[model samples]
Target: MGLLTIVTAAAVAGAGYVRARDAIVQRAQDNAVIETTNRVEQLYPLPARVFDHAALERIAGRVSGREGSAIAYGDGISAGGMDPSVITGELRSLVSSGRVGWQRVSYAGAVWLVVGMQLRITADGSSRSSGVEVYVLRPFTSEIEVVNELARNAWLIGSAVLILALGLAFLAARGVLRPVRELQLAAWQLGQGDLTARVPVRGRDELASVASTFNSTASSLEHHVGELTRMEADARRFVADVSHELRTPLAAMTAVTDVLDAETASLPGVAGQAARLVNRETLNLTRLVNDLIEVTRFDSGTAALALDDVDVAEVVRTCLRMRGFTEVSASLPDGVRARLDPRRLDVIVANLVGNALRHGAPPVSLTLSVAGSVAGSSLEILVADSGPGLPESVLPHVFARFYKADSARGRSEGSGLGLAIAWENARLHGGTLTAANRPGGGALFTLRMPLGGDA
Candidate 1:
């Protein structure tokens, strides 16, 4: 805006100055030409043919009565208050050839418009040069003053226009930019989880329209989010209540199954088979119930770290031994101690290695190593197998609860929540669990736990 104003002002001022200057110059030339022609006509035939000093002075006085003075000279006679040098050579040449001519020249530290004309002699029906000439020297001082005044006015007006334009541009920018800045800050707050963030709308301009639309969208988002949060809380409460209600009966059933298991070998064919299957199913039911309760605890945010400084190698070995994962290969580095929940670490290891042993072929391998320096150190546990790798379609959902890669395997021996629970535990420790395919073959599960107290 400012640039456009400057260019427009400069062009207008330049054009105004040019026109004023041209008009003044044109007026000065016109006046000089008219005065010289009229004086020559009045002194026609060159009074007395050849002039003495007094007669020449009379001709000078007649020609020079206007705002400027003049000179009249013919043969060896000349008279005037102004210098003859004010008439240029070019003007003198044209006039000496019996023509009236004019020119502008610099003279005596100022500009002069000079007009010269030679007297013509009339004889019979023809005319010829008489050698008597009159030259008028009109000063341009007043015209210069007029031009200077116009130029000064042009500068003053152009500057005023530019300043006014700048003031208007500043106001327009403030009106637009303040709203835009508010919108930006509100958007940032919304992204940072402030659902109540809103911008103030003013006027009925385009900026106001945009702000209104953003407020409408944010309000809808807040409404939907409120509904979802309430529903989620209710679901968690339902699961927690149901799991608690079933625990008592499940404990009683476990006691009955244990007694049945001991007497299974002493019973007859069908009863013996029935008792064994009942015992096995009761144990599986107990495991599933426990798993569901653990998931509820995670969802309710009641899960916490019970940190103990312990040897990581011993934890892994004990988890493997307790789970009868004896055939699995292990690379437990010596004396890698960390402040961690030892029970949670054991659960993480058991889930990953157990999944590998069940889903993959031996030689399954568990590798433990510390990554990064001591202050920022992290413990990484890698469990890999030599069977088929995870399907590409299943990799993205590998840690999702109850997500089975093969649909028919939904009722498989292992509960589907193992990886999900493991992931939750890793997150609770401020770490991560990831699954991938080994470069060589089969599936890989990696667990990383940060070492510092901040974890």
Candidate 2:
């Protein structure tokens, strides 16, 4: 666009230059013709009466002797190589009615300005046979000089116009591109997970409209995110409060069961059954309360890790012992150290082992290893069960809070919060937890942790 503007200015200046040069040339030519006529009338004064050839010759000789002057009349000055007599006769024939005449002539490939005036030369009061005519000539070089000056002025003006035009174009481009660059930066920030990023609205123009649109979108996105966060927080709080309320009664029931178990031998059948039911429900309620508390901590951004370096193999051994996985085969490498909050680590490992034991065949397996070689090392733990593998539909939501495979299968003895708590613990440690149906008829849960353990 800048180049095009400059070219357009140049074209306009060029046209103006051509017209100015032509006008200069034309004016100079007209002035030269007037000057020639004046010189002729001044040199050859008109007589009151007509004169013969002899009188005309005398007047022509007087005018020709002056510098930068010439004469052409009806006489021959043979030695001067100009026939004054021949030109004098033709001029007399044209000027018989007393009118001025002009003509353009060229010699030596150059144009000349010529003007003729009527001159009657009389020696006495008596009229002669004919009147005299005087002619003047000048080269067109003076007119050419005027045109050249015009051309020079035009060239300078064209250059100045081009420079000014380019400078303006540069400034305009910067103005337009500045807002676009801001929009680009805002878009990049939004893409990189900054939902609050927005462009500033400045003017009531197209760029302002773009900025307004971007700001509106950012506001909407922030509102939606805040709404979702509030909803989640409210749900977590409700669950935590309800679970706390439930735990009070369940604790009371558990105390009553303790008393009943003490008197179990005396009461025998029905008493034993009632105590078992109470004990089972008390355990379930306890698990539910713990899960609710953990979920609340996560929601309120208070979940924290008490990280310490411990051997992964040792942790796995402790977890399997606690969960009673005596028949499970375990593979672990030495020097596989990981930093983890012991309580959260216990929860993660206990859930993995419990889930496997409850659903797996006799040969459940646990594996632990360090992931990287020398510079960096991450702890990777895998628990695979040889149970009937999870279905495709269930695999996606296996770690979701309170998700169950099927209600028709009935609730398992385990709370659904176990895997969800494990997932949150993995994330709290800056680790990842994933589940997949194994190639064989089983399922696998893999947990990977960072090497530094500071996350």
Candidate 3:
């Protein structure tokens, strides 16, 4: 708006200045013609009298006032007030043709109007030229000053109009943007988790409509978020309750399965096979139930660490030995100990090694290393296997519960909760467990734990 006002004001001022200057020049030209006509009338009777150079000088003195004058005849020139040479030949030619000749020209750095006219007299009962011509040089200084003053006024008025227009535009912009600013602040609050944030509605404009829409969207979002939270909570509660209820019956089934395992050899072939199958399925059910209970503990925030000061390398070796992962090689260094949760550390190691044995090829390795001082040391356990690395698609969801990479493979032998449980245990101990593809064609699991567990 300001720019448009500026351009408009400039154009108007420029055109007004031009018109005013032209009118002033025209008025000056009209005045100059009238003065020349009056001077020529006064000179009409001079050529009728007998005149000498001295007489012509007197006539020239009467004709020329504060401006300038020149009277030209054969072998004689009378000039005063200004130089007579300023009258050029073009003006003289027009005068010889019996017409008033006038031209505006610059002389001595000032504008002057040179007017020339021929004087005539009645001789031998016929009008004849007297050979004497009158020329007048009138300066246009006063008229130029008037034009300049008009230009100054035009520009001043243009500046005032521009200022007033800019002020009005600023007020209008403020009125439009106030509601936009309110909506911006409200959006920021909503993004920061303040679901109740809202914009105050003002007039019935586009900005007001936008604010109203934002308020409606925010309200709907808050409602949906609340519903999702309750649903998630309800789902967790159901799992916890079901797992809790199944534990009692699962204990009884495990005891019965142990007896059937002892009597399997004495039964017939089909009955013995059936007994073994029942025992195997019972064990699988028990594991699934226990895993669910553990998941519930994690969901309920009941998982905790039992910190103990023990040699990390011995813990790794013991975990491998208990899990019967004898085919796996170990790079455990002795004489290194720290405050840790040995139990959760064993579980983490067991899960990693068990997963490596079940899913990967031979030449598996487990390495334990310790760093920092005893008070603030950290431990890293790297378990790698010589097998095809995890696919890029499967790496991210490796620890997700019951997530199978190949859906058509049906259910895997072990519950899919192993890696998830391992990850939870690591997180519970203020550590991290990560899986990745080894650079040299294998899968690697890295576990990092602060030696001084968060006690």
- Please provide TM-scores, in order, for all candidate models, with all chains considered together: 0.86, 0.66, 0.81
Clashing pairs in 1: none
lDDT of 1 by residue, 337-375 (tens): 988999999999998988888788999999999999655
Q: Evaluated with TM-score, which candidate comes out highest?
A: 1
Give RMSD (Å) of candidate 1 vs. truth: 3.3
- Alpha carbon deviation, residue 148, candidate 1 (Å): 2.3
Q: TM-score for candidate 1, please give it.
A: 0.86
- Which is the winner by lDDT between candidate 1 and candidate 2? 1
1 against 3, candidate with superior TM-score: 1
Please provide, for model 2 over 203-316, each residue's C-alpha lDDT reduced to its tens digit, 9 standing for 90 to 100: 799999989999898889889999998898788788878877887887787788778777776877987887777776777777778778788888788998888877778878
In the order shown, what is each candidate's alpha-carbon RMSD?
A: 3.3, 8.1, 4.1
Query: What is the TM-score ranking, best to worst?
Result: 1, 3, 2
Which stretches of candidate 2 lie above 4 Å from their native place?
Answer: 22-148, 163-228, 258-274, 333-338, 392-395, 450-452
Q: After superposition, how far is residue 266 of candidate 3 from its true place, in Å?
A: 5.3
